[model samples]
Target: MTQPSFGVIGLAVMGENLALNVESRGFPVAVYNRTAEKTKTFMAERAQGKNVTDTYTVEEFVKALAPPRKILVMVKAGKPVDAVISQLKPLLQEGDMIIDGGNSLYEDTQRRTEELEAVGLGFMGMGVSGGEEGALLGPSLMPGGTPEAYDKVESIVTKIAAQVDDGPCVTYIGPGGAGHYVKMVHNGIEYGDMQLIAEAYDLLKNALGLNHEQLSEVFAQWNQTEELNSFLIEISAEIFKKIDPETDRPLVDVILDSAGQKGTGRWTVVSSLELGIPIPTIYAAVNARVISSFKEERVAAKEQLAGPSGKYEGDVQSFIDKVRDALYCSKMCSYAQGMALMGKASEEFGFNLNLSEIARIWKGGCIIRAGFLDKIKAAFKENPKLPNLLLAPEFKQTILDRQEAWREVLAVSNQLGIPVPAFSASLDYFDSYRRDRLPQNLTQAQRDFFGAHTYERVDKPRGEFFHTEWMENS
Candidate 1:
């Protein structure tokens, strides 16, 4: 009978777990779902004897919470989110805030925030990572809104966020769509990480002739290393060890080759292109997924297209070491690309993001959680104006030390006809970033000759542009 301090809309797995997380943190929570049966079932199964309240109607859901209610909406992104907000808007009074805890497009979040704030209500676009189990226990929370709005729920969110030695994996990202934008970039980096890991697995299995068990062991060993330690690597090791009950084969081997995507990766790539930031590694990852989805085309082409007939004939242990080094170096470049894209986006969108705090919050709970994030946190802490992660002294030394191994892996993969798009793209990005001069001078000359785009001259101030009639009216 005690008044609930917070409310949750939607009874999906994430919403249910998040509500339970709040209740476990000693905050009274009211939960509601459009379908009353879900609410009934959750209250019976999950919320039994817990300090939770269930409301079957929107009016009841709104009234059960104390004044100036903080409601976390976990519905599907897009239209469903708009629908929920519409329903809540009419019943709620001024000062009641709605927190969208879904992977929504940041533009939509920007629009919703502007609209709600115009009407004297509060809106926050919060990115909740760590999936279902993390929601029940803890999640990495990225909230973007007015400082006052975030302050209202800071205690509850911080207590429920994953804790690390530095602090909890939660922070006020920035105003507008900054939180969702960060989450989108997080997913982009995830895409790059996954693709790079798959390349390593492919190299081990196809190039080195290692079986699933050996693959599992290799990843497990890599997980113990300082650089390659990550949730994805840890889970990949377990994935290779899983046995398919029906086929008695490695579960991953028995699974389909095609992959699916939910658009966040594509969004990141598109945003980077619009902002003129080069995130080639993430772009390659997204394209890899797209190519994977074309299984039929790939199967047909595999027969028609000819590939290199040679096999890898090298020292097995030495090649494995090279592959590990390549993965680590390529992974660093991929992260650099994502971080640089975020830096540019922050500038364009006025997010005023704290890159050090962002890295600190990602050290745990999230899918991209890795040991290297500590270095990133330290890098930004040491220089808040750090333009790119690749320029950080610690990271610079890592790539420099590992570039030879990275190039060796790529060379071997290329000779063996193994496609390593993410690896190739990341190496290209790294090489391009390190180079003081590039062949782009020819590109600019060509552009100027063809289209008169006006090229900047090296002999003049950087901003001065010139166009020459290369053919001399011939």
Candidate 2:
């Protein structure tokens, strides 16, 4: 007999599909939605045989499950998660398991886990990715909670996850909030990554004057390259190839440049700033979105500031090639920034994370899933504290070998007044690395000399900080 599985709370598109996925994988599931009517509606739909089943509200949801039940919560992050937990507490018995499958903040997950653990309830904060389709067809799963709790749920998650030959789309990341924290960071990285692709599209459309089919071909070919291969890259081809019948122009040209962004992109930029990671491309992406919001203002600015705009002149292929390099470089910056946040979170949360495993799981399961994910998995498996993603050997080699090409691309784009945000950032990071000594250190020294701020000793042993060095140097 199939074990009874219940998915509590959100029964939106992702949750509904996931329930279907679980049922398809041979588990009988009872689903609950916040609105009692939604549950009834779901059951009625299932009765009509339209993608739903065993639907119930909070009370019926609890009663339908067996003792020591396994219930997964799929609600909006923050207050909604807490609200559902509060309402469900009275109905749940001791030893029941609840998994948070939403995009909640990690610290909140950790706090909630401890709170639930005090009452003998087991908690798992899981990060589910691959969107609605992946949810139904086997999305990537990251679960963090008690090892024992994960062990109890592992088989269920694994069986329903996407398979890449042998590996499942699921893994137990760490203890406490690690799962959700990883997920939050995962979303953050996704924001930057999508933005870079958009920038690439914009560059191709505006600067290179490539038609939809040609641009689509470029992206399609890029998907085959290990350096730029990703689902995003692959999809870029389709987005470009889309054509509008009314005007007979590529659909991309008609789409508004001022695209809407969810909170994740803004959160990524904010989090990166807090973590002190350089993420110029991600920042550019965020800014670009913001700029889009002021469509009228921009139009006004266009009229007010209009003058001679620089014309992009050069080998179109060569410029395209350079833009590709820039995209990689900016992508590295965003990855580095996102990882830096994880490092800080790890220190704060007391969970030892495995970056390699993070990379491995992301390779095929998440939106950010891509060929380079394998490189990250390898790099972190070798050196966990890695300060920058670019320091990852493959990335290092890519930047070093193709750096000239990237710089050339940025140069040509600038010459033509093409605003290549990611491209510009890639060149900046590369040029900064090429220098033997950073002038920022000199500026820091000057700041310390005047402000009496603390400074690190150059001559002292490693990992030492010294304020007296200022006195000696001055």
Candidate 3:
């Protein structure tokens, strides 16, 4: 029999779907699972009548593939990934490639790439987005590694990736873990988008007194708008329409108040801090999830805490419009922060990332995919070194035009005791970005006085630091 074109280990839902997706694209695939039953069941069920081979061991799986073997590991991140590589190392030959299709920390990817390359093997850290369904159909693929490894698998990757109007949503991100880093930032932006949508839902329900159906209709309408059109917003509208079968209420109402995270969002925030980059909107979203975890404390404090108790008396439709504007403006801010983080990482790590191509690929098949990404792509193409998305003319004008309404929505939400941290943080980011100067001068003075950190002067040129000895002067 002819050797399989590719191999996939880990027959979990995502792994199975991706394997099937590859097979559907006319590539022969070899599949394996740590558990023999899963491999047998998958081959009997989904892999039936397809060009798929089932193998029980890592060695068998590797041997089933053609020369210059390509294997995709869809196992869980961290130790499991390392274990899989260790198991495959002794069986695989030089020029063979291992692709990690898990949500791994980029640093780990870097180490793994270095280790494998030293042994004459090629490694690719791939970021697969669009969830389980997308896995079966198509997902946005970001693969980072040596060009030769990417070239070997480019046909399969592109054929299996989600396609937008322009092309398939797959790209060679850069060398050494750039794919995972981009995916981490993508999750960070996803957190911010979800939190922003939640804030909009709260403001509409609590302040504007819109019911579930009305809110869904409003979001449906917003989805048709250029600025607010996105996968998250579309799903959010659908979510609002879902009624709980058991309770006969909106499903969201019956769901738990607390939220859960899978760590990628937190990784984004931690990376931003390490890089000295400001991603307040993403940070606020992560913080929001953390605070939501304190459900018991929140419930108890609800009765103990006193907040504004007046009903919303604003024009309801006008307020809803304001909320929509706030959502769009904040969404822009969050994207700006995410892109800025990527740009800084690209420079710092010598990835030489193409920001425009990244935006183009993200326009579809990702959690944060949005229509506005087209504008972002155009902006970066117009000026590759565009410092921030907020400064891009397309986004700048929109933010400037909608600033008043955004401010009003935030102000109203604040007055009504609604927590809109993502919205507030995005607005704060905008305000800080547009300012000619900040209060950091006083901050520097205090630092200098206490820690002798030194401070730069406005009258002097930048990078010329000075120290003030307050104790000696006194």
Candidate 4:
């Protein structure tokens, strides 16, 4: 079997591992990075015998690959990408495929695609997840661009993409920026899912006053359930239960309570706000991270603060059950926000995307992979345009059966003042969005004040418009 020609343009851990993965998949990888030292180092470490050549120059790098090549750009998302693209602009010939395999902004991807198209070059904005290892083996690949370019590269991508026992790891998400946009939402949902786990951990720690092993035991039990089974859940129990031999206590305690968030978490919150999708859980999760960063603030407030915070004692199982519900509901809200974003992007970008396929592909490998994915896969299969996760028969039934338990948890958490921000935010978004009238809709008024953005009237165009006294007087 002849190995197809491909080059990796970055040699970071992610890039290096990915190159090796491509090699493992039987495609000889030609890797080049901005730093010659790193490339030389990587070549020295691995490139031996008759298998490959490590080129020192862009021209040499381009020549090392077969014609009509597949060159994947895996550099840092922004300026580094532009610089590399500019360098390759002259080196790449007509009909070569350039894939951006970083966490790039989708809009920028669109702009670059248009620019590259003018030069007879093809572009694919890809979203690669599963981190370094995922890249080394097979990460879920979301490729968006001209179908011709995708088809040109699909042979290798399909052969190497990550999978469950069944579903494929790759999808030609749509044309233009659709792939990256889908990926952006994938990160957003990831934020929601992780935060939900954090909230559950908090509830268990607080309500039961559980120690590390106890909390670990709690998560382990949660994983036994079908709804919560996932990579995040499984590994998190490990994180909780890990003990320090010297300290004889859980490592999580010594670890700071602060959660470090990469930009994707914040991007999910901001983009959802722009699109008018209520992703309160994702937002609150981001906000929680921001608050976590306030180590000094807590200290400062302590010296100037008034009274001590209250404590609580309740049925711990009842508390756990409710926290579970809130997490599930928040999970639902985040998924809804993600699907909504996809729907909007699909319409706005003129792309035909299979949301069910997206769900099916997400089932096993990625951070958000869970049993819930199957329900989403089934729901969308039943109705591709299913309004939300909650509307799906299985999910709707799950929520309905559990709502009584969930409400009690929310009620107690509210009483306890344990800062159930993400959980409550999701519940609030759910109840209010379902409601016909939401008070304090200053967003409409503010929009009008700035751009003279006319509000739609409820009587006409849903009669959603608010009449200003100044406009009436004028």
lDDT of each: 0.93, 0.77, 0.92, 0.79
The reply for model 3, stretches above 4 Å from the true place, is none
Each model's Cα RMSD = 1.2, 3.2, 1.1, 3.2
Q: Which stretches of candidate 1 lie over 4 Å from their true place?
A: none
Which portions of model 2 show Cα errors greater than 4 Å? 1-3, 44-53, 245-248, 307-311, 385-387, 433-436, 454-474
- TM-score rank order: 3, 1, 4, 2
Which residue pairs overlap in candidate 3's backbone?
none
The sequence of per-residue lDDT tens digits that candidate 2 reaches over residues 1-474 is 344655556788777777778777766777888677877776677424532345456887777776668888888889989998998887888889899998877778999999999999999999999997788898889899999999888878988887864388678888998998788788777867887787677677777777788889999988888878998898888888888998888887887767786566666667667766666766776777787799988788987774445445678887788778777867777776677677776776677887777778887667888887777778887888887777777778877777787667666666656566755664675567568777776776787778767567667887765554567755
Alpha-carbon lDDT of model 2: 0.77
| Tens digits of per-residue lDDT for model 3, 53-92 | 9999877888788878899999999999999999999998
Candidate 1: pairs in clash: none
> What TM-score goes with each of the models?
0.98, 0.89, 0.98, 0.91
Using lDDT, rank the candidates from best to worst: 1, 3, 4, 2
Residue runs of model 4 more than 4 Å from their true location after superposition: 1-4, 44-52, 245-248, 306-312, 440-474
Tens digits of per-residue lDDT, candidate 4, 119-183, equal: 89999999888876677777888889999989999888887778776656887888887788888
User: Please, what's the RMSD in Å of model 3?
Assistant: 1.1
Report how far residue 297 has shifted in candidate 1, in Å: 1.1
